[model samples]
Target: MNRNKKNISILGSTGSVGTQTLEVARSYPEAFNVVCLGANKNTQILEDQILEFQPQAISCDYHKELSTRGEIPEKLMSLSEIATYNGVDTVVVATSGNVALIPTFEAIKKGKNIAIANKETIIMAGEQLTSLAESNSVNLMPIDSEPSAIWQCLRGENNHISKLIITASGGPFRNTPVGYLPNVTPANALQHPTWKMGPKISVDSATMMNKAFEVIEARWLFDVPWENIEVIVHPESIIHSMVEFSDGSTKAQLSYPDMMVPIKHALFFPDRAPKSNTTPFDPNKTKSLTFESLDQDKYPCFEIALKIAKRGGTWPSALSGADEA
Candidate 1:
């Protein structure tokens, strides 16, 4: 009940980003309070988080059955309920696919600050969502590393951005010949070179489709035109992203490619907390930072995705749904 602590509700408490968000909260117990949690059906991990965090309420498919066991919280809320709950201050939309879209819209409507990691939702309805957030005076903080990097770089600046340079690790098949890509296995695609992520995202990274989604996200998040946003293959992900201003000067955010850094930033915006378990980025240790132009032929999925993004409307929704399927 500390007045200084942020009351948080994580929509995907059992997923990759969700668990890391909890880790950040656990590290800074004085700064955050887990008030609510929502997950699909990962009961075992959800139960463990429930016992550890002891949130005031939770949303899960098995809530009714868990309630009968007597250890569950008194209030079992749905994802929308959790987003608009009076006791919650910020909602973390970490759930994948389109599942978190409605709940995120509800949170914005209720004027709750959102820390969203889901890309599909933004790709689908970024314009509407950003407009609603502006009208409601709510903050839609980005939890993804690229967007977070851009967000950090624009912290104290005026609206004079010239271009947004989103960085990508180029995934596991960066060096693989274009002809060999068709025969790559799922296991091969999942072996991302830099960061560990969920299976779907890993595969998306291999095809550079994740970067394409990010490009669409940046267009809406920063109000930049598609022509102004560019993606580069940075094999070493030491530099998260960069923003070039109209005055010819550029600002970039750098880290060791850790998700916790961005999550912590979103949780405690307008202020920075002390470092957690992530190692500090040392320039002396890194040999050389390299960048390459993204080859459209090598990543046809990325090109096709951007085409679909430009078309707009329900096309993005359908594309994301098809990708999920």
Candidate 2:
């Protein structure tokens, strides 16, 4: 390990966001040193990541045999253990759903910087978590593409924002008649047009639950009210998100719909390194960029999530848990 490299522990080292984060780490090896890795059940790739990164700690479901030949801790560490481990500079909380909440708060309480991708954590306890992070003086960087876009747009504005406009890809069934939604199979729903993601999030995108969660996340991350956050369906996905200033000025962040862009942004915040995984978005190829309001009837989850965001209790957690089950 280089003496000057920032040490980071990845909490969901096998998920979509986790793998993309590794790609960012791989591209900028001189800037980051991955010291710990955690996954749920994908031990095969977890072992591969352990070998490649040679992390001091590793973890997976309950317990499992690992095939790595390095000096990893004899006992597998839990996500929280890796999160709050001493000398860890940053904890990348990419674990899906509410699983990330406890470990994320642990890292925050321990004063470790957080780069988070899990929207469920915010939905479940955005108020509490943001307050905890602020009180600890820890940086709670957002890794979700939409929130990251808003973060970039809000830069230098210093709380001068009036509204947040979150963009949605509208999923595979955007054009499908509302009457046919009940018969859509899981396989059909998983086919996201612009982004490749896990099944749960993909399904959430289809139902607009993912956007709903993003609205909640944006509210917490930017300290905006739920009433000020709006969702629009941008089929092209070229524009990730936008922010409107109090004076009617609007700024937006645009990039190719690649998760690596946001992941890398979080990893080297306050600084930017050369990116290998994301290419500049081409407006010529984009042809027609369009936006439309979300059809409430088509995605009832959106309104429900907004209500849960305002309610701010265990309701959001319950909604996510029920979706998982």
Candidate 3:
């Protein structure tokens, strides 16, 4: 590793995005370093990743494993400690659900730059979270695809953006008959048509619940109105997302369906570093791009998400937690 590379701490170190993040850090030896890693129950994958990255610190929900092993590097109690480690510079909140909120808030309070991948934290507590970040002048780089696309285009311009049109791949049920939804088995729901993801997210996608969650996240993340938050079904998944400006112009961010691109970019904002496993995108050779308004009638989950964002306070938190139970 380069002596001058920025130190990074990745929460959720064994999951899909977290694994890709390690691959990016490995690929860019000169630009970044993994100083900390945290996981819940997947200690085996976590064990393998730790042996490779050799992060300065690590954490997991289980402490018995750490007790049994004596050769491991820095191990800590909390995400908050990982975020504010002495030599660590960038904090990546890759953990699932609202569990990331407090630790991410701890990072911001200490003035650490954050590369946020977790959406539940922002979806439920966005108003409070954004206000806290602003109060401290923290640079909250987005690791999610839609927000990153908007941020990339919104840079270096005073031009007003009128609408934030977040695209959805419409998941496995995008085409399953309307009445077929209630009968949608978890087995069918888990099969995402395009992206490879963990079980919770995969299930969320099929029910259109992830897009619903995104609606709320966008509301506070961009400081936009709930009504202005829009979703389009682009089953091809080529057009990751788009933005519409007040001057009648639209900017779109297109890439092949890969989570690593946004993950790497968020960690290395203001500078694009090299990474592996992402398919190179080519617009000319690409097949086709399609878009359509979200069918609220077919997908009531999306509508409930929008309504929760508009209503404000506790409801969004309740729904997300209910999913966990």
Which lDDT values do the candidates have, in the order given? 0.91, 0.85, 0.80
The numbered model that scores best in lDDT is 1
List candidate 2 segments past 4 Å from native: 1-3, 68-72, 275-277
lDDT of each residue in 1-325, candidate 1, tens digit only = 5568999999999999999999999999989999999998788888888889998889997764453333688888889999898867899999998999999999999989999999988988999999999999999899999999999999988488899999998889889998887898999999999999989999999988899999999999989999999999899998999999999999999899899999999999868876668887999999999999988889999989999989988998888887888
* Candidate order, TM-score descending: 1, 2, 3
Give per-model TM-scores. 0.97, 0.95, 0.94
In TM-score terms, candidate 1 sits at: 0.97
Q: What's the true lDDT of residue 44 in model 2? A: 74
Q: What is the lDDT of residue 54 in candidate 1?
A: 90
Instruction: After the best TM-score superposition of candidate 2, give how far the Cα of residue 211 lies from its true spot, in angstroms.
Output: 0.7
Residue 188 accuracy (lDDT) in model 2: 97
lDDT of 1 at 261: 90
- Location of the lowest summed lDDT over 10 successive residues in candidate 3: 62-71
Per residue, candidate 2 scores C-alpha lDDT tens digits across 1-325 of 4659889999998888899888888888889999889998887788788778888877677445655454456657788999997889889998886787899999999999999998878878888999999999998899988999998897777577788999998999999999998999999989999998888888889889889888888888888877898899999898999998888899999998888888888899888765464688887777788998899999998898677657657777787787777
For model 3, the stretches where C-alpha displacement exceeds 4 angstroms are 1-3, 66-70, 274-277
Pick by lDDT: 1 or 2, better one: 1
